[model samples]
Target: MSIGETPARPRKKKKHTGRNIILSVVALIVIAGLVAGGYLWNLGRTFDSNSSKITDAFPAEETRPEVKEESKDAINILLLGTDTREVRSDETEEDEFATLPGGGRSDTMMLVHIPSDRKNVFVTSIMRDTWLDIPGVGTAKINRAFASGGVPKAVETLEGLFGIRINHVASIDFEGFKGMTDAVGGVTINNPIAFRPVHNKSYYFPEGEQKLNGEEALAFVRERKAFTGAGGSDYRRVKNQQLFVKAILGQILSKETLTSPAKIQGIVQEMAPYVAVDESLDATKVAGIASSMLNIRSSDMEFFTLPNNGPGRSADGQSIVIPDMDTIEKFGEALQRDTVDQFVASTDLSK
Candidate 1:
């Protein structure tokens, strides 16, 4: 609801390690606030040179959407959590959560809409398994759009589908999630259901309000398969991911967290190293956005999934989500008209 909810810039990624994907969301909020608070310069000049940049990620003229902007206006960003395929043999110990699909797959994607007044933030969680067309490539799972073309391709794919202009893009790895989470001293969540986490059966949580440290939170979100009898609900996991992000934002928004420069810088330091952001998301951009959003509060936030009918087997037997086009178009229209509040109020959020 309040400012410091997420990084002001847009970001993207592959392979939805539910918790890791949300880390991108966390980084945008944490780092952007640091820049606004003057902690950025104190961190030194290495900040700019240190972060990896995604090349040619902006959409071309022909494919671009018409957007209106003032010095202060609404911003649409894509936060991506990716599974980078590089095999890091240098590390003495393996990061258990980092092990994922071979190709760079944005395991999780979130499109955040920040209104002009910045009173409230509306978020849409995109299910990776949703069947859709990729620009230059044919129809496939939406997550695969990033595999070969990287950030640019993924941005184009979303632009094509949503018909909205993306102002910034940030991509982060799984390891960054844990580091950032721990830096904030862990998060407390109202666990909706209790089950064994997907990757590690050893870690289990009861259905109740609980506090989870970095590692436990990561496993908490990844547990889609254990909750339901049929097992593995991508949509269900997405809800968990959304709640986790909101909870983290709430943690940072408190007076104690915001006043503490060390905690903010610590998150930025741990998160910045693993983030790959588009050219538009510099300290200047982050600071400009954060300064205007200092009044935001947790109650001003809203979360929902994208519209999809149900799941079906592809021709080749691959499982995929069936998107509801009529519903998607209306949502896109709301984004373009800057009437997200009305749209969210009138329609049902994706299940």
Candidate 2:
């Protein structure tokens, strides 16, 4: 070896470390893909097998609001929560739309809006006692629309009021709250106010963040009687419900839950039995919708109640919540224009 001749370079032994690392990563990715694919397939099957379907849930196209070009890709889903203890066996389908389960008296109503960008989800709660004109039934509480004409009438009334088209409807019995809460191994929520659920007085929820099991969650979301005065209005219940929603979404999306195939499967199976969606929202459609929103996180969800005057009484002396149409109309317009983010930013959501 001559010192000045760049010491006869020893031929470098071939290194396979980089290639081996690449191969190992590719193999792991393939295995993970297989596992995830199998898990999702099973989940879809379970969801389809247990869920119920509603036919022709929407009203006539002429009667509902027209979808604007900017809002064409946005999705609006109406979620109804009902306490259906009695089943009317003699009910008949009216105007092609089948009567919703629990005879169509919705206790909880929310309009879920997902914009075209899919960056955020907005949920606006509508009080059951809100006074609005029901189609074909004249003036009445909004909830009466559901009982009078089921899904079609309910959809018509809301579409007319907001001037925004509703794309889908999903009805869930109150019993679902328990099963879903338990399936997710119970949701942990921050409790702003403390109270006991009306049905179960023994379960007291204290203020601050706490974990609630199935029974406790049911009570927490359903305890309207515990609140009194201005704060006790349906606003409290809606707030609690919204909080539960955010908490459950966080839990379901957590790495611990998403990584566990059994937990994800259990959630779908348990929730499906109590849910009924419009015919178009089948398991495959649902999976597609979920896939599109893969980037969404719990923090991206925004919840607010439709603006309304505190409380009022109808002409007949029945108590009601008077909607602040002036403000809500602006919200609706934003929906049509697909500028809800700006509308939400400029407007006050304290109500």
Best by lDDT: 2
lDDT of 1 by residue, 1-351 (tens): 377776444343234456686898899888876665565565434446666776676767788766744312688888876655453463222122322222334667888889888888887888887889988878877766665466667778887787787888877665676777898999899987777765577798888999888888777665566656321467678888898888888888878788888898777787777777787787677767776888987778999888888788778887788888898999887787788898888988746
Residue clash pairs of candidate 2: none
Per-prediction backbone clash count: 29, 0
Stretches of candidate 1 off by over 4 Å are 1-38, 43-49, 68-72, 84-104, 229-232
Per residue, candidate 2 scores C-alpha lDDT tens digits across 41-160 of 888888888988877899988898778999999999999876554433532232112236745446688999999999999999988778888989998877778767778998999889
TM-score of each: 0.80, 0.87
Q: Evaluate model 1: give its TM-score.
A: 0.80
Residue 265, candidate 1: how far off, in angstroms? 1.4
Per-residue error for 300 in candidate 2, Å, reads 0.4
Which candidate comes out best when scored by TM-score?
A: 2
- TM value for model 2: 0.87
